[model samples]
Target: MTGHLHPLHEALERLDEAWGDADDAGQLSRRQLIAVTEALGLLHRRSGAMLAEVAACVAHESRTELGAASLAKEQGFRNAAQLIATTTGATAGDASRLVKVGEATAPRRNLLGEATPPKYPAAQQALAAGRLSAPAVAAIIALLDRVRLTLGATETAEAERLLVERAQGLSLDDVRRLVTRAEAWLDPDGVAPREQEQRDRTSLSIFERDGRIHLDGDFDAARGAPIVAAVNGYVSALFAAQKEQIDPEAPDAARRSVAALRAEALSVLCAHALGCEDEAPALAGASVVVRIDVSDLADGTGYATIDGSDLPISVSTARRLAAGGGVIPCVLGTDREILDYGRERRFFTRAQRLALAERDGGCAMCGLPPSMTRAHHIRWWKRDAGPTDLENGVLLCESCHHRIHDNDWEIRIEGTGRQSRVWFIPPPHVDPDRTPRLGGRARYDVVA
Candidate 1:
C-alpha cells in the first residue's frame, strides 16, 4: 500500500480495533446488539471490497496471462471453480461465481494496445469501494446479463449504476428486487418473453448423498419467488417457534442450522406435492421418530435425535417439526420405558388440500391466491391432536401462517358446510377485547 489507505479500508481497520475492545458487547440491550450487528456487517462489506480487489488480480494473472482454463486443467482440477473451491473451501457455486466476477470486473485492453473500459464499470467501482459483496456483484451480473441485449447498453449501464447505489446498505435479496424492477422497466415488451424464456429454463433435481438430500435447480421468477417465500417463511417460523419454546431463564439451546431447517422445509413441501398422487405413499408412515430422554423433553432444555441422523435438535424444534405432520416424538423414561408415543395421523391428505382450497378461498387471514397458501390445521393437529378433516383444515398463505403462530393469533371455523366461515381471533395486544374477525367477501349495500 503506497498511497494512504482507502477510506473504507481505514474505517474497517478502526472498526476492528474498536470491536476488539468491546469484549462485553454480548450483554448489550437488543437495540445495541442490533447496532453491533450492523457495524460488523459493514466491516464485512469493507472486507468484501478487498476481496474483490484481490480476486481481480488473481483473475487477471491466472486467466489472462497463464490461461486459467488450460492451467487449471494441467493442475489436475476439473476447472477454475474446482481450483478455487479446493483452496477456499467454498461450494462450487460460490467459487465459480467469484471466478466469473473477477473476470468480468478485471481490466481490459484492445488488440491495438488501447485501454478498454470494464464491462460493468459501476459494479467495479462499488466492489473496489467495499459497497458490494462478491455475491451481490454476481447477482447484479446475473440479472443484467439475462436481458442486456434487449435492454440496450445505455439502459443496462443505467440499471447497473442505480443498482450499485441501492445495494450499499441493502441485502442481496433487496438488490435482486431492485434489478428485477429495473429490468422490467427497461424492457416492457421483453418482460413476458424473458419470463417465458426463464420458464423454459426451469428445472429441479433431488438426490440422496450419505443420508442427506442434495437439491439443485434453477427457476424463473414466477416459480422461484414462491419457493423463496415458502423457505423464508418456514425458516422464520422455525426460529420463532424455538424462541417461544425457550424457558426464558436457562441457556438458550442452539437451533438447527439454517441449512438443516431449509432441508426440512423442503421435505415438508415434497410431502405436500407427493400427496397429490392417488396411490402416493403415506408420508406420515415414514415418520421422523425423535427419541428424547423424557427429562429433556419436559425441561425443554435438552436435545433429541431424529432417526437416521446423529444431529440432535432441541426439544423445542423437535416439537415444532412434529406439529401436525411427519415427525413422531417418542419420549422414554429413565429406565428407557416408553413414556409417550406421538400419534401418526397428522399431515393433511391431498384430497384434504383440494377440499380446503375450494372452501377457504385462499388464505383464511389474507386473500392471497390459493396457489400461494399452505394447508394449515386450524386446531393445530400436533398440539391439539386435531384430525386432518375439512372442518379443521384451511388454506393460509405462508406469511399469515407464520403470523398466526408467532403473533399468537387464533383461528377457528364457524358454522356448518356450505355456510361455514373461517375466522381469526386477534391477540389481546392486537385487539384489547380480542375481536373475532371473519373471512369472506364484504358486501356493502349501495342504492343505484
Candidate 2:
C-alpha cells in the first residue's frame, strides 16, 4: 500500500525485509521456509491476475478489425498472445491462457458504454484477492465457458462461484478433478458424446529413434484408465523389486528411474497382451476399478468414475468396462469371512490377497496402494515352510519385499484378522539393537 511503490513491489520489499535475502532461503527454519513459500505463491497468483488484465487490454488493441493499426502488427508480432509471450517470456500456451482469463475476468462495456460485471466474476474476484492461482482461474473459466451454452445464466454463475470456492487451497490436479466432476454433474447427457469424442481421438504412434523404440500416444479416459492403472501397478512392483538391491557398490544394484521403469512396464504390458505370459502373476496385477452409485447404475442417468482417472464416464460405458475380463467387479458392503488356507496352496489366493489388502492397506512398508502390492509369505514358503494362510502371509510391494529380504529384515504379526498389526524388525546392520518398526496400516496411521 506504499504510495510510490507498486503493490507487487511493495509486497516484494516487505517479503525481502521479513525473510532477508532469497539466497538464504535454505538457511531459514522449517516454519520460515513454509511461510515464505506461501507468501511467494500468493504474490505469484496476484501477479498472474495483473498480467492477465494487461494481456486482455493488449489483445483488444490488437484486434484483427484494426488491421494495419493493430498494436501487435505495429510491434511486428503475429498477434497479442505472441507479443505478450515474447514480452513476458511465457510459453505460447501460457500467454494464450492469460489472454483468455483476462478477457473473461475483465469488465465488459455495452454499446452505450455501460460497464458490466466480468464473464466469470467469481474467478476474477478470487484471482484479484490472490485466493486462486492463474492456472486454477483458467481451469474454472474454461469449464464455465464450455458449459455456458448448455446451462442457464443463474446455474452457470452458481457453478462458477462453487468451483472458485472449492478450488481455493487445492492443487491443480485436484482442481482438474473438481472441474471434471462438475462438468459431468452439469451436463450428464453430454457425457456419452464426450466419451465418444475422446475415443475417436485415441491414437498411438511407435517409431524407432536412435536405436530405441519411441512410443507416442494419446488415449481417452476410458481407454487410458486401464493402461495407466496397469503401468502404475507394474512400476510399483518394479520399484519394490528395485529396493531389494541395497548394496550400492554391488553389480546388480538397481538404479532405474520411474521413466525407465515405465518403459519396461509398457514393454511387459504389450508382451502380456500378446500371450507371452512367462512372467510371475504379480506383473499382471493391474485391474481397472470403476465405481458407480447403485441408483446411477439402475437409472442410467449419472456418471461413473474409473480409478486413476479424473474423467467421468456414462453408466453405459461403465457397464461395458465392468464386463471386461481384465476389469475386477468388486462389491462393497459385504460381510464375508476371511479365508485362510493353511499350507493347502503354495501361493496366496486372490481371497487371501483381498484380506491382506484390507489388513495392510497396500505395501505394508512403503504404503503403496492395494493394487500395487502383492501378498507374500512372512514365513518363507519353501525355506521356512510357512503356511499360505492369513497369519503367515503379508501384503508387500516388490520393493519392500526385496529390501526386507536383502537387508535381512523380519516381519511379525501381533494380532489376528482386521485387528492385526505388522512389524518389521531391523537387522543388526540397520539397528545395532534390532528394533521393531511398525509396519502395515498402523505404520502410516491410515486408520486413525
Candidate 3:
C-alpha cells in the first residue's frame, strides 16, 4: 500500500487482488469470461516477471555462501536446478527454464545492495510492460548475449529495441526471424563461423529402450531450419487426417495430442529422408532386415527377429515392414537355418513408386499428398506370397502406415481397373461386425 514498498510485494498484492476479482468465474457470462481470462493473463505475466526477478536474486545470493547454498546443500541438493526443483514443486526441466530465464533477464545489485540495471534492459522493460511473454524475453536475452560478442553494447541495445517492437506486433516466430535477420545483417561474416561452431556441437543419437525408438539430436540453424520445415509439412498432413477423423473446427477435440503428431512427423521425415536418392550411401540400402522362421511365415502367428536385435518384432509389424518402409526379408528354416535373403527383390522399385503415385493420388488411407505417403503392400509379401507390384501396393500416409503396423488393422486391394479400391478393416474391438471402409475419395466425383 506504501509508495516505498518492494515491487515483488506489490506484485503479489496485485495478483491476490486479481484472483479475488475473478472469484465468480463460473457465474460469469461467456463473453465476460473470455474478457476476464485475457485480463487475468496480463496480471499473471506481471506477477510472474516479479517472481522471476526474485528467483534471480535468490540464485545470485545462493552463488555466494551467504544464501540458499548451505541450506540447500544440507538438504542433499548438489545443484541450483535440483535445489529449485526440490523447494518448488516443479519438474527439473521447468526449474531449469525458470533459472535460465531469471539469470538472463532479471535485475541485479552490487555488494552494498544498491539497485542495478538488468543485463537485457529492453527485454526487462518489455516483460514488466506485459508486452513480451517469458519465452520471448528468454529468447531475446540468449540471442543478445551472442550478438553482444559481435556488436558493441550500443548496437546490441538497438537490436533489442527493434526485437521488442517486433515482439509486440508479431508472433514469436516473427521475433525469431527478426533476431536471425539482425544477426545476419550486423555480422554477415560471423554467421558461417557461428554456424560451424554450432554444427561442431551437433550430434544425433537413436536408441531403442522399453520397446520404443528414442531419438535425441542437436542441429545447427542452417541444418535445423529445413528439418523443422520438413517435420511441419508432415505434421500438417497428420493434423489434416485428424481433422477428417474428428472435428476440423475444434482441434482440441482431435483424438491425438500435438506430441503424438510431432512424433509421427519425425517418422515421416525419416521415411522421406530415406526415399531421397542423395542420402548417405550407408542408408541408401537401409532395408529393415526382418528374420522370420518358415513356420512363423506359414502359420502367421510368431515374432520376426529383426537384424541387429535379438528381441522379436510382432508378426503384424514384420508383415507391414516387409510390405512398407522397405525391408530385407531374411526367411529362416527350422533350427535357425537361413532359407532366403530377399534383397532389393522384395523392396518396391522406383518405377513402382511412380506407378503408386499415379494410382493412389496421395495417401490411400487419409488422402494426403503423394509425397506424404509410402507404398505399402496390401497383401503380405512374406506371408501371402504377395508380389512387389502395383496390384498389391497401396499408398498410405505415415500416421496410417503406423496405425496398420502398430494396431490390429487390416488393408486389402479389391476390384479391377477404375473400380479397383483399397479397403481398410478396423480391429474387432472397434466393430464386431468388422465392416470395411474404403481408403481415399471416390475415383469419380458424385454430385450431391
Candidate 3, 307-351: lDDT as tens digits: 222123445556666775445565655332211223336878755
Candidate 2 per-residue lDDT over residues 1-448, each given as its tens digit = 5542265675576567667655687788665675677778877888888889999999999999999999999999999989999999999898999999999999999999999998889998998888898888998889888898999899999888888877776667657757877888888889999999989999999899898888889998888977787888877655445466533443221566777777777887787768865664244366676666667777888787665465778888889888887775443322335577888799888778766765675678866766777789988988999989988988886778889999899899987766688988988866678888776655422121
Candidate 1: tens digits of C-alpha lDDT, residues 385-411: 876777777777667888898999987
- lDDT scores for all predictions? 0.60, 0.77, 0.59
TM-score of 1: 0.45
The pairs that clash in candidate 1 are: none
TM-score of each: 0.45, 0.71, 0.45
Off by over 4 Å in 1: 1-9, 24-35, 64-76, 112-116, 198-448
Worst 10 residues of 3 by lDDT: 439-448
Error of 1 at 349 (Å): 33
- Alpha-carbon deviation at 220 in model 1, angstroms: 6.8
Clashing pairs in 3: none
Worst 10 residues of 1 by lDDT: 439-448
C-alpha displacement of 340 in model 1, angstroms? 56
Q: Go through the candidates in order and give the C-alpha RMSD of each one to the true structure.
A: 18.2, 8.8, 19.8
